[model samples]
Target: MKNKFLLLTWLLAVPLLWGGCDKPLFKTDEASIAQPDELPPITTTGEGTFACKINGVNWQRCGGGFLQSSIIGEWHPVYKIFSLQGLRSCEGFDDAVYINAFIDSIGLYPLEAGQYDDFNLECQDVLDQYFLLETADNWVEILNLNTDEFIVSGTFQCTLVHEGCGDTLFITDGRFDYDWAN
Candidate 1:
């Protein structure tokens, strides 16, 4: 008698407890407007963030899956080269910006090709347009680099000249924080 009573109570109570709700438990505002792009917070503790404004529009890295990186940084001790690359792709459009600084110390480097060190910004835009660094008016600054942790943080702004047409690409408010070891 006791087992039968408990079984009946369990079945009756379970249905009433689970099926009593007539409305959703959580609500998301369907009429809510999308927010504008905001830059990620600058960090140096291996947050793997990279962002910049291209032609006054905000952009950030995206691609993430097996053995891939949206933001990556590396420092070669032998050659003393620092490399950083960021990639974003969506809606059949793609963009990439990268820098290879051949400097031994942390500082600002002009966007120029010189005998000792080379600093260049190679940007590929949405229409597969090619832009290369030309003039020295643009620059990149190495703000902080933690060699022990493989984290690098920096700021950059550059003007790249188009290859096909004689146009210019302005990259501003650029910042990156990456940990290659992670």
Candidate 2:
């Protein structure tokens, strides 16, 4: 009778032990920078001397950054195209999607511990809300995964409901290119 009780206790404890622990994390592998010879063709459309402005003031250049990624297996230029919907100048935006341009200031954030895959980028809006965009999604399809430049050509709109300002929509369209700064 004692043996039966002990066996029952052990069986219950075994499951609890297994279920309580989180999954073990794995390290991501590293990818090398693509050689100039193997580098993918860069899109010449909208290239050279591009600029942007926010609230009628000149802002930073749209593209000119680089990121290193093991997944991409090369030093990829952080370039992509994005489209915006429902945006207007001097209007309070509430519910709209906008195509916001972005540049990869830093290399991709690691999906694993200490792994830097150039597939991730830190993007922000005119308001400076940080959006950590990743290339693992459909972005890989829009931008040539083999080249440092990829294009994200789609309509994105944002609908914002500001309590004080009511609501507004913002949208834009453009291409982004990236270069290594540091």
Provide the lowest-lDDT 10-residue window in model 2: 112-121
Q: Give each model's whole-structure lDDT.
A: 0.63, 0.26
Per-residue lDDT of 51 in model 2:
20
The clash count of every prediction, one per candidate, is 0, 35
lDDT, candidate 2, at 136: 23
lDDT of 1 at 58: 72
lDDT of each residue in 1-182, candidate 2, tens digit only: 99999999999998788776674233222123211222122343322222222212222222223221101111334453222222211111111122233423322222210111111222323443322233322121123222334322121112222222332212112222322121
lDDT of 1 at 104: 59
Best by TM-score: 1
Over 4 Å off in model 2, which ranges?
Answer: 1-141, 145-161, 180-182
